[model samples]
Target: MQIWIFSYLHFLWALNKSMIIEWTHKRKNSHYISMIR
Candidate 1:
C-alpha cells in the first residue's frame, strides 16, 4: 500500500518532467489494485 502511494506521488512529480516510464511488474500491478480498492 505504501509503495502504491509512493509511486502515485512520484507520478505527480513526473508530470513536471515529462511522464512516468511504463509501469511493468509490481509497479503497475499495485497501482491498478490500489485504484480498485
Candidate 2:
C-alpha cells in the first residue's frame, strides 16, 4: 500500500513537470511570434 501511494505521487509529479515545461514552451513561442510581427 505504501509503495503504491509513493508511485502514484511520483507519477503526478512527473506529469506536472511535463505540463509546466510545455506551458513555458508555448509561452516562449508566442512571445517570439509577437516579436516577429
Candidate 3:
C-alpha cells in the first residue's frame, strides 16, 4: 500500500513537471514568432 501511494504520487509529480515544461516551451515559441512578425 505504501509503495502504491508513492508510485502514484511520483507519477503525478512527473506529469505536472512535464506539463509545465511543455507549456513554457510553447509560450517561448509563441513569443519568438510574435517578435518575428
Candidate 4:
C-alpha cells in the first residue's frame, strides 16, 4: 500500500511537470509570434 501511494504521487508529479513544460513552450511560441507580427 505504501509503494502504491508513492508511485501514484510520482505519476502526478511527472504529469504536472510535463504540463508546466508544455505551458511554457506555448507561451514562448506566442511571444515569438507576437514579436514577428
TM-score of each candidate structure, all chains considered together: 0.41, 0.97, 0.95, 0.98
Q: What is the lDDT of residue 25 in candidate 2?
A: 100
Measured over all alpha carbons after superposition, the RMSD of each candidate to the real structure, in angstroms, is 14.5, 0.3, 0.4, 0.2
Q: Which stretches of candidate 3 lie over 4 Å from their true place?
A: none
lDDT of 2 by residue, 13-33 (tens): 999999999999999999999
- For model 2, the stretches where C-alpha displacement exceeds 4 angstroms are none
Residue range 1-37, candidate 1, lDDT tens digits: 9999999999888875553354355588898999999
Candidate 2 has its poorest 10 consecutive residues by lDDT at 1-10
TM-score ranking from best candidate downward = 4, 2, 3, 1
Candidate 4 clashing pairs? none
- Better model by TM-score, 1 or 3? 3
Task: List the pairs of residues colliding in candidate 2.
Answer: none
Higher-scoring candidate on lDDT, 1 or 4:
4
Candidate 3's TM-score reads 0.95
Candidate 1 whole-model C-alpha lDDT, 0 to 1 = 0.77
Candidate 1 deviation (Cα RMSD)? 14.5
lDDT of 3: 1.00
